[model samples]
Target: NCIIAASDYYLDDDGKKAADLYQKACEFGHPDGCKWAGWLYMTGFGVDSDYVRAIKFYDVACKADDLEACVNIGFMFENGAGVDQSYSAARDIYHLACERGALQGCNNLGYFYQEGRGVEKDIRKAKSLYEKSCNDEAVWGCNNLGGLYYKGLGVERDIQKMLHYNKMACDRDLTIGCDALGAIYLHGRGVPIDYQRALEYFQKSCSNNSMLGCSFLATMYASGQGVTKNLKKGLKLLTRACEHGSNLGCNLLKVHLANEKAQ
Candidate 1:
């Protein structure tokens, strides 16, 4: 009912109606509803953008001690949305959510340690937290862990392990992971040159809407490395990739078309 009301209010731009339903839901102990109200206020969705009110609603939900709300508070503190920036406050909220087994909290903590945002730079701790998040099936964590391994950040330079983690993340449907793995395979890093595997991974990434993936898959098709030469199909994919925000795709597609015209 609250969802329906929110949806209806959204369609009609009825700020008062949305606020009323959100208030009722919050009063009923629905932390999610409270969080949504906070978001609505924060983004000015059907209401005037009010960071103060957003913070108030988030504070109310945080007081309920929900892990998600704790994470939101961490974000708020980290970004100083409605309050003064306080790394300590962000760290505490992140810790609270981590204690509650929120994988995202682990990932955020890893980011904090990596960037020394609120703490000293500790690559070891960052890797540990990322590993924990990956174990919890966090795709972002797994993908970033693969990057860490690739960069040898606080870990031994093990290219094979990098590919392994990239493959793991890609198999879990992470487009970035798939694109990274495709690059690794294409360059024969940590493994023998396997354009077929690279093509497959790039295709998977492209299917997931990765511009780089589409561009690279087009390259492979044009080169006839992993598949037969098909300029028309390759050009189509390149155009699509370019439309999807890849300047590399646009440049390559232009070069390809020019070469074809010359031929």
Candidate 2:
């Protein structure tokens, strides 16, 4: 019943009905139903956002051995949403999830170690965890491993390694990876600047809701670095970024305007 209600026939206005049906399915012992109920409550697609309610449903699923539910619970604990902030609890939950074969949980735990949120900072541990996850094809793990190489944390700076990991993530369609790759080429980060390559990557990420990618794309267009200069197109791109909450885009729009007026 819930699946039918939530199929292509589900409309935005039917959030309440969908959530209720999912909750009913949970009552029937369906873990996925419980998970869906929790997610809908957590995100408030068409209902009031209620973290407490979300956690309650998620707990039901988690107790049923849902590793994904455990990871979601950890996120709430990590951020203190509807529950007292407890990094230790979050860490424990992530460990449980990771130990149980949840790759995303391993990535989360690695971040905790890297930032020392609930444990001592251990760059080696973070790197190891990221490596494990990345080797398993976790997109976040690949991107994060690339970050370690870029920042030289617990490892020597290696642009090639950074490029390698980021490319791995990007190949998996990770927007952040695409954005980072674009920046690398645009700024000549340990490599000769290649505006053309940068443009390709920025195009991928920008089209996928990355404001930073859009901002960088605007730079390429405005400066005529790798493509023909077109002030109108540049301004339109900048406007798109600015409307999407990019301070850099807003600032760049001003500069673009001033430059155009001076010409």
Q: What is the TM-score of each candidate against the true structure?
A: 0.76, 0.92
Clash number by candidate, in order: 0, 0
Q: lDDT of each prediction vs. the true structure?
A: 0.84, 0.90
* Model 1: residues with Cα > 4 Å off, grouped in runs: 1-28, 34-62, 72-90
Error of 1 at 82 (Å): 7.1
RMSD of each: 4.3, 2.0
After TM-score superposition, what is the CA distance of residue 81 in candidate 1 from its true location, in Å? 6.3
lDDT of 1 by residue, 1-263 (tens): 88578768967978767877886788788876787788788788777887778878878887876566667778889988888999888987887788788777888888889889889999999998888888534777787788888888889888878887878889988899999999888988777989989999999999989999999999988888789998888999999989888999999999999999999
At residue 174, what lDDT does model 1 achieve? 85
